[model samples]
Structures are given as C-alpha cells and as structure tokens.
Target: MVQTVISVAGASADCPEWVLIDLQGSLETRHPVPLSGRFVGDLHFTQKDVPILIIGHHILYGKTVHLEKPFAVLVKKERSADTSMETDQNVSGTSYHVKALIRRKLLFKTRPKPIISNVPKKL
Candidate 1:
C-alpha cells in the first residue's frame, strides 16, 4: 500500500473560492472532499480513517462567502497483508490478539488573501 497527499490552494482574482475534490486511489477508493472556509467537516478515507477539519465558507443570503481560515485533509494507506499477532491475558483468562501499525501525516495550507486598497485620493 502507498500513501498520498493532496494539497489545494485558493485561486487568484475573480476566481471561485469553492472547490470540489474527487480523490481516486489504487484500491478503487473514491472520496468527495469539498473546499470551503465556513463550517468544518470530516473527510473519511475508506471506512476507518477520518480526518477532521473546518470548512472554508457558508452559503448565506443565496451567496457563498469565504471564511477566515482554510482547511485540509490527510489520508494514509493500510495493507491487509501486513499483520501482526499478539496475545493478552485478562482476568477472565481470555486471550486477545491485535495488530499495530504506523501512519504518516500530511499537511495542507490555505492560500493567502489578496490585499485591498486603502489609499486616499487627492483632488
């Protein structure tokens, strides 16, 4: 199994701040990741791994506006063939086995906001 990171940046002038992301992987995995800055949401990879982050914008007054901060999602790959066996004895004398593995972290940053004009005009 292989891990991949997807980084999205905000667009330039007159561009849309909202974006829809469709992620496809080797395991036939399909995930929809919406980009906004309003309310936060969670990105679920497969059935077990889910990354939590804030949404970028909100649809209010029939319009979509950007939020103050940006958001991101992280995904890691896990293999079924890679397994480990462990035995644990409890008070009931029952044996419990489990598998342990490590996953890497992915980081995504938001685009910088455009500067506005604040100069005064002289007549």
Candidate 2:
C-alpha cells in the first residue's frame, strides 16, 4: 500500500501524460519513481505542492508543479546559472538580477526552464 507519491522528474515539453494507479492507493511509474519511503516523506514534508506522478487504478493525469516564480524570474535564473559572473545587468533603464533557491528539506533541486527572451536590449 502506498500512502504518498513524489515525482522528481519526467515531464516533457510541458505536456500532459498518463500514468497508472494501483488498488493499493499507490502510484506506479514504469521507470521506478524513487518510491523509497524516506525520500517521499522528505519531499512531502518539505516541498509545498510538489509535482507528483499519479498512477490511479483507472485514471492517469499529467500535471506539473511550479515554484511560483514569475516568467521573468525564471529567465533570469537560467541566465545566471550558466556563468559564475555577476548576474546583475542594467540594460536600457531596467535592472535584472538572478537568484537560486534550494529547498532546505528535499535533496532534489529544480531549475527554471531555459527561455530566450526576444526583448531587444539597449546596446
């Protein structure tokens, strides 16, 4: 019997996929989604509203959990991850900064999606 489910990764292109749920109230994944009790407990207790793969007995739904970061924040975070240099930039009259946040309870980390902003910058 499974009491909880936690998904570390396996989302593709922001698309929804189907999964299988067992009669034991446990979610099943084809690729063994870290079902260890310790891991799931840590994740559930720590990460608020973490994306989980639900394999129901008759229904499967694909869902994703976001860190509540704005689109601009995600872009800036990725740009900063690429380098060790200062991420503060003053383009045109706006200011941009990048920051990385790690959950203190879960060992797994989530990075923002890589986005290429088409906004023209002042040369």
| lDDT, candidates in the order shown | 0.29, 0.31
Give lDDT for model 1: 0.29
Worst 10 residues of 2 by lDDT: 98-107
Best by TM-score: 1
Candidate 2 lDDT over 13-110, as tens digits, reads 34233322112234356686676763221112216544333222222222333334422211122333444255334322222342222222211223
lDDT score of residue 24 within candidate 2:
25
Q: State the lDDT at 103 in candidate 2.
A: 20
TM-score of each: 0.18, 0.14
